[model samples]
Target: MVPTMMLVADSSRDAHRREALCDLADAVARRGEAPVVSSFGTSDELESAVASVDGPLVVVPAFLAGSDRVSAELLAGLDLDQRFDACATPPLGAVPSIVGSLARRLGQAGWRPGDGVVLAADGAFDQDERQQLTSVARMLSRRVQSPVQVGYLDAWAPSVGDAVERLRRRGQRRVCVASWQLVDGAGHERLRELDATAVTAPLWPAGVVVDTLLSQHRAATARLAA
Candidate 1:
């Protein structure tokens, strides 16, 4: 029997968050896969979904940060049935195609060749997670042909405002903030408050997001089969 693909998303009050997850799930469904969406907002919601499923299960962490801790935290208290095989794939942030989508968003936001760029995200407390975010900024730098600095909305250092200010002090007349968030929420609101030339949209509903989720599902399914 085919395994059920479960996409576990971060909890957010933002309505776009639900739409984004549904869009991704729908995209997967269109590909003839069984896609189930759940959230970490409530343990019961996630647990119930798992209980309803039979056979193998593939859990995809839908976080843009791709932090393993986030995945672990989501599943920490869940009671997995011994009869069902279950496994999880890496978070969506690890998908390399995301850089390309970010570059396109930057361009759409009127980014110029020499404009300073800051990749703004909801900062992670974990050191390794921070490094992973920095790596994403480096990849984005190469794609946009500009120096991309990492900025945090919360949790870690160089705050979004500070990153923008640093770029301004460096004589960059225009600074653009590329949002590293998956959906519109507090992080995006924080980015808007920054003194920058422009703030690009979040990654929700992007084709890359759909593709990344599906790819992760396929990889997990293959691993389970082996």
Candidate 2:
């Protein structure tokens, strides 16, 4: 039997968000060849799941950017050498699929060629992760053929509202917000107050996203097998 592949997602107290992520994991499991599916927001949950699953397992982080505190906890709990077959894959944001999805979502949100855009990410306090978000924003700028500014939901400078206002000050009335989130959460709730012409939905259930995840699983399996 092939080693099972599981994804660890950011856990939420919100029942709706939890259900949605589980649904997405199920959907991915169905679409791909990954045998097992599990998500853990906390280290305790992660340890329990790892103990329950036998044999080799490939753990994939469903996060977009740099690792968060929860992810750190999960990592700290894992003794990879003890379970030599198990390995963690990079975050989903490291792939190009997100960029493709962002462009498509922006188009669907009525974005025009010249429309000013803001890539709103769940900002990280760490400088490296913050740079990662900025890099993605620049990639988006190239894809959209417009200046795509970066906005944070938590820390760092330039909130989404500030980005929209800056664009408006430049006389760009039509501004669209591309949400760089996997699922709607409290951060998304705050996006409601942002003054923008349109805000795209979170990236989920997209063909590109599923394909990217499947590819990550394949890579992990291959690496572990090697």
Winning model by TM-score: 2
lDDT of each: 0.74, 0.75
Write the residue-wise lDDT of candidate 1 on 1-226 in tens digits: 6778887865545575667666666776777766565564556778787778777888776676633234445655665546448887656564468888988899998899999999887766356566778889889998888899888776567888999999999999999999887666555776788778999988776877877877888888888888
Quote each prediction's TM-score: 0.88, 0.90
Compose the digit string of candidate 2's lDDT tens values, residues 1-226.
5778787865646666676678778887887486867765567677788778888888876656732434534564666677887888766663566887888899998899999998887666356566777778888888888999887665556878888889999999899998887766666677767778988877886867777878888888888888
Off by over 4 Å in 1: 66-72, 75-84
**Which candidate gets the maximum lDDT versus the true structure?**
2
Query: Per-residue lDDT for 66 in model 1?
Result: 30
In model 2, how large is the Cα lDDT of residue 53? 84
The regions of model 2 sitting more than 4 angstroms off are: 66-79, 125-128
* Window of ten residues with lowest summed lDDT in model 1: 66-75
Worst 10 residues of 2 by lDDT: 66-75
